[model samples]
Target: KQKLVPRRRVLSRSADLAEDYRITSDNVLHLVLKLSDLNLITVRTTCGQEIEFLVDRYRNVISLKHHIFQEGKGFPSQRA
Candidate 1:
């Protein structure tokens, strides 16, 4: 009988496996993981106020516009 091991466990123990598969790089491993959580976007208002917000990369532009509107900022209205 053969025993089976989970790929996750094997990859965790072996750096070579990860490197060969290009799962991560030495410098960017943490950064790549962090990018999944949020992306930073800087918005400059007409009043010269610079605002920074963290947004999900998967969100659509319409949703982002609504978010900015809720923050009391103006965004160009979308036409259907």
Candidate 2:
């Protein structure tokens, strides 16, 4: 028999989009791995503009690095 590898379960948006579990701009989300119990993350977004996601085991990107908005309408483009 051939070896079997398990795939990571993706959190589908459809399943959580129902009326019972409506997703809002201020709602917080958690990504948990039921199989291995290894990956556990939490994400929170404000006004649906920016998000803050972090894993319990990692400490690399736990803060902001740049401005939330860089450009907008009638702004100059980056192309030459």
Candidate 3:
């Protein structure tokens, strides 16, 4: 009789590993994964114009605000 062992699956892409498992103490990997998964956010301007933006999920409020300001014309006075 022969004993058999299960083969571990290999992840071809870094993104796959990042998404599937919790990598301990890997801030760079986490950041990379977060940046890769983009979320679409819709914002209504004070002038009543609706705009959509594709942004990273892990972006902080300040970073988001800066992005909105640079790409979306102007930054809102209130928190987004």
Best by lDDT: 3
My TM-score estimates for the predictions, one after another, are 0.45, 0.21, 0.42
Steric clash pairs (candidate 1):
none
Per-residue CA lDDT of model 1 for 1-80, tens digit only, reads: 22213333333443355545455334333211234557888877766666677899988899778777777435443444
> Candidate 3 residues 1-80, lDDT tens each?
22211223334454464446444454333121323477888877776777778878878788778876776666455555
Model 2: per-residue Cα lDDT over 1-80, one tens digit each: 12221233334444443334554556555555434323344333332333333333433442222211321223444567
Candidate 1: segments with Cα more than 4 A from true spot: 1-34, 73-80
Q: Of 1 and 3, which scores higher on lDDT?
A: 3
Pairs clashing within candidate 2: none
Question: After aligning candidate 3 to the native by TM-score, how far in Å is the CA of 72 from where it should be?
Answer: 4.1
The C-alpha RMSD of each candidate to the native structure, in angstroms, is 10.4, 15.8, 12.7
lDDT of 3: 0.57
Name the weakest run of 10 consecutive residues (lDDT summed) in model 3.
1-10
After superposition, candidate 2 runs with Cα above 4 Å error: 1-20, 35-80
